[model samples]
Target: MPYRHLFKALQWGLILFCLCFAMVGGTMAERLLELLQCQPHANPALRSCAWLPNALGLRLAPFLSAGGISDYPFVLLQNFWALIAVWMVALIATHRAARNAASTAALPDRGKTRYPGITGADAGRWASRAAFWVLLLGLAGFCMAFGTPILGNRVALEVLGALGCSPGTFDPFSSPCMSAPGFWTHRLAVYVIPLAGPLLAPVWLFMAFWDILLAWTLLTAAAYILQDHLSKRARRPAP
Candidate 1:
């Protein structure tokens, strides 16, 4: 089988996935950071940036609500779907391309050419494919991990109610103001959670990287099993 089309499809799939992730995920992350930075400030000028209270609130609502952290998983799911979609499309395109190339080939080209295992060209091709898949998979995993909690409840309160240093309630000088060490600790949590969430995601990626390896191993194992079975059958006495 001509692997060139398959290779091309994977290439395009990676590009499409990255573009979509950057456009959607990147935009959300930026706005989140902006909201976090500006919403906490006491200055009326910074707070009155038109996209205040309600606007920013709506953007952050998913992550700010009690279980807002779930939104990250939801977003990560979205990224996965995007990659899946691209991969499927690429598969179809690769099949069509292979068919077309086959149809145009010389009739005598029906015979298969055997290669001495893992030639330089073959190794290079495998390396390129591995690299691209790794890059895309890594980013998607990171999005699911880091992206989920970066703008979660703790972070939300910090950004939305940082001045109050209170939990549950946003009104700082209201009847139930938070002045105790508990309030301060909660405030510290709010600050630290958002800051650490993003950083931790990437760091955790190192651990999660095993997921990619496992997937590759399973796929390759399946291929090897099929190949071994076929090889054994070929060597069998007339069956």
Candidate 2:
């Protein structure tokens, strides 16, 4: 129950942050779109990057679509990715603290000059350091909804169909690419070309949707581990 609450809290916190991010990104895009005479009107609530300030210009969220993040779906993805980052950071910190405590306990404690917190395990520190990349990739996926199709053509198929050609007809093997009038989405089948082996398929999707599904799982696992370690710490009578 405690974990459930933590999970929900993380989810909601990430959602709230993502909404704020979307609003900021959308407002900036609207301003850009308006200046360029692309969309003409501004939709701060939606992603209409037209009259953007001269500074941002076309470089606005090069990875994410213009108005794509303004939508709620991507907001959820962003929040989830943020949660993943939080989880990773927490895990890293806890792991480092544990190692430090262990190493200190093992040391002779001669009061000599040494790093106060000496965690001998380099692996934890390294992985924890990698948390930055997790945040970066997660942020990218968060801003723009990363889609991995388990079934069906793709979520963007209809939008693509609405535009001109059928997205489904596009070669899935070559690239997991599909576009709408002003948007693009990918399916796992298209991403994991050959669509044959289980390992390759999941790995491909993991690479694409890592910020979402993989990140989510990693966060969940990290949270569990952190809670376990914290509980163990709690049970031990402090010195």
Candidate 3:
């Protein structure tokens, strides 16, 4: 029982970690863009030179950023890829832990009441719930990372305007006058492409659905492991 509780704690902790990790990366990318924009003194040639903020972004920069003023797609894709990697790692680890716990639970007991913990049916149920929760959580995480900074920047723009910072042409790291609307428009590409565009050629749907399935699989494994441990503890000799 003690270990079972620990397993649950770990599962929750990992999910939180993944969420935070994703948010952090998103924040970094957003900040980098802001930083680039603020550097008005940069060389003329370097003005338009914007690097991908994340690894995946860097990898797909050439293909995605083609003819685009802003490479928002790369940034979003990086965050998406990072989230998936983290989630997959956590799921695999949890699955292994669950398997071990289940095996331990099957050991012969001297004499005690044995109660079933996680069963095959339980796994299916738990997975469904986990998938739902993960989907919501993932959305929140992604938004916090990718959207919050933009919102903050919007506020900053308003405050600057109030303080007398005049808006100028939206230039890449050149003119101090940055167009928030333009920024948003450029960033919107990241969302539009996957949600509605023809980039994935229908593969996007599968990627979107993968989250739910992945979450279910991971949580089910964790639940089964913890339940098995609890079941084993239930049959132990009581003093």
Candidate 4:
């Protein structure tokens, strides 16, 4: 419990950081999509599209562009969510570990004696199983989120390619293209590419989610260490 206040402050700070980053990334992503679909000369509603891309370009120039310059915000948003998920798992693991340790320590005879019917070992084993399931489910959810966009992108691209439309040359959002075959496929790609492309990029994956996972591991380890120290202290004989 030493530096508990500091730890809490740091946790809140990280949450705030993630929230702000996600918000900014989401906004940028929306704007980037708008810019891509905008035809300012042809559409009166898209006049702001001219300045928005320029502004985003200026802001994002210094940062690493994953997949492409336009895909950076989506990558950032993906990593932000990944970080949040990892934090949730870490918190659950830490809480379960600490609670089990405390329960074991509180049992008679240094957790060796059974109270009534349930023993400390039983409690620890149950906690361990619960933690394992929680971790497994969290990992499954992460993988699903990570892969969904990629799968969608691939299917969309395949559809477009089969219809003889080149994604690079096709303008799916244009009025003329509205009647084109595979229009929906192109539409899907437009949405999926922002998410899928960056995730597929090894450099971006390393730059973003890898760091988040590493931080989660370190924080969880630190929490367990602290919990173990407290449990050991409680187990010592009173002077």
Residue pairs in collision within model 4: none
RMSD of each: 15.0, 13.3, 15.9, 15.7
lDDT of 3 by residue, 1-239 (tens): 45456557767875664454334544454455455453222222233333222222332323333333344444445435665576566666666767767776776773223545567756655565565556556655543433443443443343333222333433332333333333333332222332233233233333433564476557656666655665566567788
The estimated TM-scores of all candidates read 0.25, 0.26, 0.30, 0.30
**lDDT tens digits by residue: candidate 1, 154-208:** 3434444534334333433332333333323333332233345345544433443
Stretches > 4 Å off in candidate 2? 1-19, 22-25, 28-166, 169-239
Residue 51 Cα positional deviation in candidate 3, in Å, after optimal superposition: 18
Query: What are the Cα lDDT values of the candidates?
Result: 0.47, 0.45, 0.45, 0.47
Worst 10 residues of 2 by lDDT: 175-184
Sorting all predicted structures by TM-score, with the top scorer first, yields 4, 3, 2, 1
Which pairs of residues collide in candidate 3? 168-177
Instruction: Give each model's clash number.
Output: 1, 18, 1, 0
For candidate 3, give the lDDT of residue 173.
22
Model 2 lDDT vs. the true structure? 0.45
